[model samples]
Target chain A: MPREITGFSNPLIKRVRSLRDKKHRRREGLFLAEGLRILAEAEEAGFLPEMLFYARESAEHPIVRRLVRATEAAGGDVIETIPDILHKLSGKENPQTVIGVYPERIVPLSALDRSSADIWIVAQSLRDPGNLGTILRTGDAVGAGGLILIDDCVDPFSVEAVRASMGALFTQTIATARWDEFVSWLRAGPGQLIGTSLNTDQDYQMPTYQRPCFLLVGNESQGLPTTYEKDCDILVKIPMLGKADSLNAAVATAVMAYELLNQRRAR
Target chain B: MPREITGFSNPLIKRVRSLRDKKHRRREGLFLAEGLRILAEAEEAGFLPEMLFYARESAEHPIVRRLVRATEAAGGDVIETIPDILHKLSGKENPQTVIGVYPERIVPLSALDRSSADIWIVAQSLRDPGNLGTILRTGDAVGAGGLILIDDCVDPFSVEAVRASMGALFTQTIATARWDEFVSWLRAGPGQLIGTSLNTDQDYQMPTYQRPCFLLVGNESQGLPTTYEKDCDILVKIPMLGKADSLNAAVATAVMAYELLNQRRAR
Candidate 1:
């Protein structure tokens, strides 16, 4: 039988709470996810939780009960905690009442694109954890093949990102690839390459991305760096009609990805 | 002369710290904004600060100095304190070394459009504060004329929303308008109404968007509402070639908004 952590001071509980900080996440190589919807998605994706902390209140919830069964069947511990204990352990006043501990995931490039996409998003130097999470969730929803982070991206497995992603991170494939590797892969792919830029001459719709393609988005503030300036095969723009000249990195990337998705379906 | 608070135990400091809570925000009808950039934006937008809290260590920053001057000029109180005190007073560790207490913005609908875009974004049932903030920032950066909250959307002026906006909230006109009033306005505008829906039968390009108009986005989990189903004159989709069925709310809205922006520029 697995151990039941009745208090927040329990070593395992302490370790789980420590994940809210970057250091603990790195040391343990673990992240945290909550909410029944997210847990359900994880279960559907064939993820096995190491521990399932469920609340008495949520025990009646179908998904929560299902998750407990799934974890038990997977040979994991299912610890039932009172609502107050669950809240203390979660550090959230309104805890979801269902928490899971799963291993950290770092998607491989090969596994990311089991099949190609009409448009794939490459995030370079995007540092905000919230933006990264939002982008990953959007990429998953838009059905992008995967996401590529060139350099200096905040870890996608961070707690803030997991909360922002609401579990879409598991559904999306993310790879950390260098620039040289990206270039070679670009040359190998059948899709056209498009990158967002401020002064780009090409309109977003100028090209018909009929096949698999790459849509690269840059940092939160300064866009594509000068080094990658030459790396772009074609520069496209989402025209600006006001003084504010840029969109949020994730939002811009999703829009570009949507354009490609739009074209593919139209054909 | 406005009173200057000098102690950590001051009631003003407690009230300022309470701004971090949603209930406090609702009760006080005020919110806190961090950093010098947001303060400047708020100041420029004529949203006067009632209390300016500056860390004694960073009162010399040019932007911080400017905020001080603006607050003084506007008859607001400027409170200078040690970094620790500022952190305590501001309800955030490190607290940008500076923060300003500003009034909640109530954007009048008539002030939204002028020489700018006829393209607007009406988010119906957007639930995430971060997503709303990202969309607000993205909308400003992409030169969106305005943003209209249709129904069941989080309060856009929430602290999380303002922080995610990245200073874009003060740059554009944002208002909470009823769904019926806003949709009628979009329909009356010079553009076609495009809405993303799981029930859509066409791509965004299918109808050719004969008029300048609004693109309606539904909540992240729930796509555009069934009630607004009939309001969308053009029902379009961003095709999903992968596993996910939808994009994050902000990303999807940005993508849709920019498509309209791109289309306008092409014309």
Candidate 2:
């Protein structure tokens, strides 16, 4: 049986509210969800929620109740709170119906198909939660082999990341692994590695997707570190036509991903 | 001649902070800025500032003092404030030591080069500020004719939007007009009007970009409303290979714009 906690002072509610802080999220190994869609996505993806709370109005909705029951059945803790409590936890308006706290799911590189990939994405050190989420969603949309997140990236499971992903947080299998180990394994492969840089003479289209390839994009402000650029088998760039020397990290990633997919499809 | 206002209750200060509220932004026909780069872009793009505030730290810097003097001499209200007061008005971390309130800039369609365009982007009611901003930036980079924001779109001039635009907010001449007026102009146009939709049989590649065209993308969640679909000369879609039926509004807009640009370049 699950116990109901009513007050804002309750430790669990306090924990959920504090999930906004990076320290709390790290300590609890849990993250926040603002509305029903994210909770529903987590549930559908078979992610086990640690806890889910419904605003009083949401408690009456059949979908909300059903999801709560499912969460409990799956060994998740469920709670109902006054709207104010929910608001306190969310610190945002119209949190829809339900909020959830879930354990982060980390995938292993063994989980990704290596041989079948015509293209793959390697994300290195992004800071924004929303940017990470959008990148995951884009990688999923383009049918890339899989995503590899290098260290110092935003915690992929953060609330802002999840909300920006719009349920893609559940659908994409992004895993965290040692950057050195992944690169070492990648060195052994017949696959080619492509990285973006300003000085590269290689246009992205040169010697591209006829074989499995990896596309590496770096952080927004400071780009691919010099250490990794030398390791790339192919360093190329999307030809720039405008004075703006940059594209948002996710936009650049998407453009390259789409081009790789299109080139492979044509072959 | 400039005056420094110290009171929190001052109407001007309150109005500036009210910019944090969306309704006030709409009612006042004004938006806020927090940094030097944005201020410079605004000036370069010919936006006249209504008021300016500078901090003591920034006032000592040559560029800051120059801007302060210029803004005052331009017949704009200038207030010199302590760093603490300037920070409050910007609502941003690491305040840029300067803030400006500027009226919205809108261009007339008569000013657009109708003959030079084979591609136009119609943003149909996108409500997210970042996504809308990215759309404008991408539209300009990919060489789309220009951006079209329909009813229900968020204030593209919002601080978050302007920042994400990466200075495209200044270079891109965006015209805000009635969607119906846009549609009637498209109907009389020398180009094909393409709207992005999920159910459309018209694949994005169906028409080559050998001719002038318009691509309309819908809002973040509920895509193009049905009435607007009727307005599209041709509705085309970026093929989604994944289960998620969509991409972020900005990403989708970029992909579509790039496709047009890519097609034209190929020809």
Candidate 3:
């Protein structure tokens, strides 16, 4: 049986709400994910919420019932709360019926097997949580092994990013490291570092991407620094036939990712 | 010389600030755009703002001087204001040094020249302004003729959409029409309607996209209704090789748009 919490000032509710903040999430080693579908995706990805909260009306839902069973089986706490508490936890006008608090799953850079997939995505100094999430989704779509974040990228565990990811965060391997650390890791492995640059004359589609190809994208505004570009094995540019000088960071990543996937498939 | 205004309560100041709201923008037939770079892009695209606002600090900027000259020459209002006014107008902590209120540009579906470009983007019931803006940027990057919005969608002239467009709003032609009206217009022209759908077995890259291809993407949430999907000339699905079932609406559009572009280029 799930615990019933009617009080607005419940301690558990307050604790769950604090997961919205990055500091609190990092300190607790847990992050919040909402919506029945997302929570279901997490379960499908072999994850069980440490704590699950659902509105009273959703207790009869088949997926909710299954989630409650699985969470209980995993010795996790399940709580039934009111719509007000759901709204408070999600910080949205229309909150999801269910919310989950899951452990942060950041894979170490050294642990990633480059041979697990033919393609990988690397983002340096990516600032937008939404873009990060979108990239994760695109990475998953293209069957990339994982996403490697270099330098100060936005927290992948943020509510905005988690929501924007549409559950791709649970699907893709995520690793964070300094630029030097990432460079050393790449040098130790058999992978081609393909950087998207404006300075390059080579078109994006011109190259035959090698197996274990690492597609490197730059920051939202500044793009990749010259030093980082110099480290790349291949530099390519997407043609901008219109007056706009560049595509959105996430959009550029998707275009490049699909190109890599197409090239490998054609081969 | 530009008119100088310091009072926060000045009528013109209040009026420009009100342009941030959709209701005011629609009523006045003007929309707000900010940043020197975006305004420069706008100028390069042959648009003169009806009213241009610049901080006194930016008076010496070469681009700002050129803009002032062009605005004055075109009989547009040019105002020299403080940072506070710019901040208020842009609704950003560190606002752009310049802001412009330009006339809204929404071309009718009948007015679009189908022969102008080999590819066009069509979106149905897209709700997010950021996604809408990103799609505009993608359309511009691929040299697509324009973006055709179907049914009720977010206001293209909203400040959020304009900012997210990153000045692509000035380069790409924007049109809005209801589903029936759009179908009529499309039938009257030479174009292929390719839709991204999960219901199809056809791969997105398998088909040779016909010239003047119209890549249609649906809503962020519900996707295209069954009726809309049935209306498409070619329905294809992007392979989701991972756990995530779909891509972000804008990401899907970009993926599909580039595929169309690539197919055309190969021919």
The best candidate in terms of DockQ = 3
As for TM-score, the candidate ahead, 2 or 3, is: 3
- Output the worst ten-in-a-row residue range by lDDT, candidate 1 chain B: B108-117
Give the alpha carbon lDDT tens digit for every residue of B1-267 in model 2. 668887778898888888877789889888787677667766766665789888866677776777777788789998887776776886666676778888767676666676776667777777888887787778667766677776877888888898788767776767766787887666665878777887677777667754677778887889988887887667787776654678888888777778887777777
Who wins the lDDT comparison?
3
RMSD of 2: 3.1
**lDDT per model vs. reference:** 0.74, 0.76, 0.92
Clashing pairs in 2: B118-B212, B118-B213
TM-score, chain B, model 1, is 0.88
- The collision pairs in model 1 are A141-B246, A191-A212, B190-B212, B191-B211, B191-B212, B192-B211
Task: Give lDDT: candidate 1, residue B162.
Answer: 82
Query: What tens-digit string does per-residue lDDT give for candidate 2 at A44-117?
Result: 76775778888666676877877878888978888877888887888777555677887766778767766866
> What local lDDT score does residue A229 receive in model 3, on the 0 to 100 scale?
97
Docking class of 1: medium
Q: Give iRMSD, candidate 3.
A: 0.8
Candidate 3: the clashing residue pairs are none
Cα lDDT of model 3 by residue, B80-107, tens digit? 9999989988999998989999999999
Ranking by lDDT: 3, 2, 1
